[model samples]
Target: MGRIVALDFGMKRTGMAHTDEMQLIASGLTTVATPELIPFLVDYLKTETVDVLVVGEPKQMDNSASESEELIQAFLKKLKAACPDLNVARQDERFTSKLAVQSMVASGMKKKKRQDKALVDEISAVLILQAYLDRKPFI
Candidate 1:
């Protein structure tokens, strides 16, 4: 089976993660500046076959859509148009960022690294992908 990819899309940077071909583990891939994402993905896809694209869906605590929803919707539309055959899915990402930060602190990362937004984004992507995988069997 082809690998799966996850995206944590943000205004300034986009975090990426991918599963192994066996679809077992989700690993943080990289963080790219927002402006570089499309070209980067387009090039990466040329050399890699991805079966699914999981995008983080930000939502409010009460389950209302967050402000990022609109941007995510636009990105999803463009993603579908770019890769019509790939399955695109969304997973709620309410606490991924906070979880990422906590994880970094627990890991004893330096203050600078712990505060790195890009690193947090990448970790959040991994968390998002893991959440999606956990739900797949039920779906």
Candidate 2:
């Protein structure tokens, strides 16, 4: 009924993506500075109808929590406190950045664009949301 938002939380910049109101397609939104992420989300939610949030959880190749997990956990806590009625979920984000680069290369994106970290982050958010949408069980 409402849009599903996904976030690729990074230390420097955070990426965002969202689904249509019907939750059919996942599209890249934008990358925001890490410090401005919460404010940006708060502002966006004020104007949009978000049913659920899918945040990318960084993990190591050995399935262990990455060093950034603590930061992400803190952010999650902040988000939960800020939006108690919102449903928030996490999706494994291993290799998402690598996959984004590979996808960009395969798609023949220009070198300048492919090198843009913001674009990579946005694409990573899209990938994370698509994975969540593909795997979530909707009743």
Candidate 3:
């Protein structure tokens, strides 16, 4: 079996997470600057076989797509073009960042660590991937 990856894409930074080949657990991989993503993913994929790509889909409380949808869609298109065989999926990521912050506080992380947006994003990506894994029997 191949691994699955999740992405929390942003304008400035992008968070990444992945599951083991067995797909039993999700773990944070890294947070990379947006400009460095494609190369990072390309190099990462050289050693890892990614079966699917799960991207965070931002939405409003009323279930409407947020402004980030357009940007994500564009990125998805580029991703698909770059890796035609890879399946891409999206999961709703409404309050993941807020939840990540709360989790950090609850875990007794130092205030300085809790304030790291990249770390928060990475955790959010892990949460997103976990949610997806919970829903799919294949995972």
Best prediction by lDDT: 2
Give one digit per residue, the lDDT tens place, for model 2 in 50-75.
99999998888899999999999999
Go through the candidates in order and give each one's C-alpha lDDT.
0.90, 0.94, 0.90
Candidate 2 segments exceeding 4 Å error: none
The C-alpha local distance difference test score for the whole of candidate 2 amounts to: 0.94
lDDT (C-alpha) at residue 30 in model 3: 95
lDDT of 3: 0.90
Write out the backbone clash pairs for model 1.
none
Q: Quick one: RMSD of model 2?
A: 1.0
Q: Which stretches of candidate 1 lie over 4 Å from their true place?
A: none
Residue lDDT tens for model 3, 17-132 = 99999888999999999888877888888899988889999999999999989988888787777777878888888899999999999999999999899999999999899988
| lDDT score for candidate 1 against the true structure | 0.90
Q: Against the hidden reference, what TM-scores do the models get?
A: 0.94, 0.96, 0.96
Q: After superposition, how far is residue 14 of candidate 3 from its true place, in Å?
A: 0.5
Residue pairs in collision within model 3: none
Could you report the Cα RMSD, in angstroms, for every candidate shown?
Answer: 1.6, 1.0, 1.1
TM-score of 1: 0.94
Q: In model 3, which runs have C-alpha deviations exceeding 4 angstroms?
A: none
Task: Kindly provide the TM-score of model 2 when superposed on the true structure, using C-alpha atoms.
Answer: 0.96
